[model samples]
Target: MKKSDLALGIFLLSAIIFMIIPMPAALLDILLALNISIALIILLNALFSQEALNMSSFPSILLFTTLFRISLNISSTKLILTTGAPGNVVTTFGNFVGGGDLIVGIIVYIVLIIIQFIVINKGSERVAEVTARFTLDAMPGKQMAIDADLNTGAITDVQARERREKIQEESSFFGAMDGATKYVKGDATAGLVITFINFIGGIAIGMFRQGLGFNEALDRYTILTIGDGLVSQIPSLMISLATGILVTKVSKEADMGDILVKQLFSIPKVLYMVGAAMIFLGITTPLNVVVFSAYGLLFIISGRVIANRIEIAGIEEEVNTDESSADEIRRPENVTSLLQVDPIELEFGYGIIPLADTNQGGDLLDRVVMIRRQVALELGCVVPMIRLRDNIQLKPNQYVIKIKGTPVSEGEILFDHYMAMNPGYVEEEITGIPTFEPSFHLPAIWITESQRERAESLGYTVVDPPSIIATHLTEVIRNNLGELLTRQDVQNLINNVQESNSTLISELIPKLLGIGEVQKVLQNLLKEGISIRDLITILETLADFASTTRDTDVLTEYVRQSLKRAISNKYFPDSETTSVVTLDPKIEQEIMGSVKQTEQGTYLTLDPEKTQDIIHSVGEEVSKLENLGKNPIIITSPIVRMYFKKLTSDYYKDLIVISYNEIESDVELQSVGMVTA
Candidate 1:
């Protein structure tokens, strides 16, 4: 049988024995039995409330003991005193003159007190121990409850109470003590103290006699050495037992306070407050009172000492089963395969330190669990069981993209390593056109007039720079000066040439200018930070003497000659180089060439094959460009009628379209309507 069952049986048997005891002995035994029975009732209630105990006989046992003890204590004590049994027995047992009989009586009383103290203390410790075990078992559920409550911020006292109620409903009687286990383990000494106090109270209640005033009864009770002070303690002892039971059930544990209180409440009943009143009115037991009160006093001191030490119980090292599964899975003989550090900028400083001689892994498992939960919440998916040494697979659908092999700064090699690990991810790079190619290798012709003055005012200057002249042959070649060049194709050519040559600008600058235009050109070239020495070559070429320099309407034929000669001589020192060069010659050419002719009266010419294709292509392009502009137009060279084969239909088109000031009037080119073709 369990300890509690044994205790219950013992108490019940004692109650029965006291009920049937020879009358003189029955009185004191019965009172002691009642207190014992009450303690047993509390123990049985704690275990049975959850229906864990087959205590169908408990009610019968309890009622029987209560009746038997009450009837016997009153009847037996009456019979004993009336027959002078105690006095006769004491005298016969020892020599009172030398104090032998008194000493023997005292020893018997002391033994009784020791027995009572042990019973209460043992019961109290048992309750605490059982309750603590139940508490440890419920830890996971309790942890979940607290976490859920904290997360929702709705953890009010009412919610806590409700939680307790729910636990109580779901749990066995002992389970109610789960919450109290921690407190109880730390209060074992207090449980002892309470037990001692209750025993002392029992003795206090047992020592009283009946029929006297309060002080008079007390004096008589004081003379009763065996049960002195016991009668007065009955009520307190009962209260303590009841309180300890409720507390143990609800808290799932007991401490020294419980033992002390139980002792207080379970004292011999005749010295209870009612008994005290009875003592004043002439009814209590002197011998019972003396023994109970003396024991109560002894218990108080011992109970305090026990309370102080109970909290110090050694926690044995048991493998926490919850942690065992994780421990068993730790990758032994493993090396760190991947490490992901957040805010890679902190890799050099605030990153995780090496764990040797450190606390880094103290809560590593919890951290991993928390992170896994967070990741699940974020991704709206369940993650696989993560093993400490298992590699994180980078499947296409896996959201975590990469991991690092080593710590690194932001934008540093480790970051690059991280970026490289993901096969399909794109890295950032630069794509805009570089400036050197367009200026030096393309037929970057600038209009001298449109109205050339208007073109100049918008910061569009006719390029006459030395670098322009020197690169002229190369530009013509790049622009398809001798080959078919689509605009896009021309752009690609220039880009290719620039990419191929590191100093393309230096090679092209000195070839394109003449001395006659040098001063005006030099100013422009110098504005871009070019040297006068390079300009001197172009000036010297113009000195070969080709033209009059002062003409206003156009450059003297000689100036064009000097400039062209200089450009050709520099880019193509071998005559075969000049023969190989070409300028813009594609569909856009035919269109611009046609526009140059018919839009104005300028002298222009086109091959028959080119002219017709030009007209067709220009017509197609004009239709598209029309939609692109607010009041769209086909703009062409200003001085040549053949320059403009077409014009837009709107008057405001002139205001919006780009032009040159060399045109005498806006009428230099005019539009009829949408082209019929």
Candidate 2:
């Protein structure tokens, strides 16, 4: 076991032993001194701690200390009743501090008991209860604030986790403190009862058992009992004060001492007023004028020093600002500086700056971060950081999304309005400015915020401007993920996969296929809206097939066949049947015949007219399926699936093309339409 753990175990066992076994006066004095030292240590810790969580172990420590003190009280009571002496510590306190008078010692001990029980302990208990309630009640809001910061990239994952853990610790510390205060309250009550019992029982034992006179018994027993009470109560008072300070502490980065010094003397005006009042009192009152005047002079001098410091600080701040401004003006800008471009950039007009500015209460950066996370989960690749800035050249409501310095999508939004799009079945019409939904190019109207409920009631989906832009950005990135996956990105994926499947990575990478080749396969999958999250499975499949072929297209087809279950679940969910369009047997055979193999790779050797006729036929079937409210998934034989997807991807990017072998055996296919040529 650790030395600290062994020491704690031995110490707790000693506390238990002290109650049953009586120790000599010297040992008792040593333990009593240790108790006072421990209480002082706890109090100092509480005073210096900036946050309650910094002393989270205090509740358990409080319980142990209270038990230790109670055991000491029991042992000392026994020693006093039997021998008319508790210990040197108690005897010294009774004689010196209590003035060697029975009446004075009893009065002083009673006052200590009353102060500890009624004042410090009571106040600490109430504060602990209230602080616990507030901490628990505010937990959810604090957690949500952490999440918001995380989503906005204001904090990273590690920082967010730390903040969440701190919040939990604060709540638990207060809750434990709420219960621990009861131990203090009970200890104070026990001390009061123990003192009374010690006095009466000691007097009876001294007179009846030891044959002492009444006056002698009273003097000896009372002095020892009062001394023991003072010894215990003083430490109890210190502990109670510490508990109050801990629960009442406000969480900040600076300790209580620093906070007090900074805030209590922050303003010189209050110090000056107090100093003047003290001087006036010295002049008018019968109090010692010299003492009051001396304090007043000290206060006046301190205030003057503080005021001078504040003035100097202001001057320094202004000088620093001037130097910074001069440095900025003297710095030269070069044309090469403008050559750096963001991988993804969103430019907003000046009027829409509030949508991205955090100081203006805009959550657009947070929304963009969430969009990146969502895209990463859906596409199995991290979206590049989006740089948001204002462009003065654009129209006031306009925005543009750029990829690698080139604008790919543009849209306009009314900052104060909501975009309501008809779900294609709404019977009621809403009046507003007609516009196309930037994400999907669907007909939508920009309506006022007040019209949102009515528009929703009429079967329209309403979204705010930031959400509209975020959605547009998501779609643009999803469509262009192929261009973003460099060989380095593939290496990152391999390194990630290596953590769990080292054997597969070592065997597959740089052996059968290089990173460039793997990048092509990943791009091919991403280009078709397929997720590459299952990298281990993809690499394993490649390990088996890559040795036979260097062709990326052929390899991609093989990988697709291996991911049948994932692909099937994406479109069909939990269903056992899939609705799809199929080609006629003649058309399938004719297309298969046009596929020619060469040294470079495979190619389709079909005539232009034949291909056009086939495209038209397939387009008609797809349209028919769409009109029936079904996704247009085309099922072709395994050999022609890749070629067919390549042929139609430019025109029908949203169409899903799967092969016969790609369908899981448990799924039944129901033909909804057919393409014939």
Best by TM-score: 2
By lDDT, the best candidate is 2
The sequence of per-residue lDDT tens digits that candidate 1 reaches over residues 373-490 is 6533432222333322212332211111111222111111111011111112224222221222222232222332232344334443333222231232222222211112123432
lDDT accuracy of residue 592 in candidate 2: 83
Which segments of candidate 2 are over 4 A away from where they belong?
1-334, 574-577, 589-602
Q: Put down candidate 2 lDDT per residue, 408-471, tens digits, no spaces.
A: 9999999899999988989799899999999889999999978999999999999999889889
TM-score of each: 0.23, 0.53
Rate residue 249 of model 1 by lDDT.
46
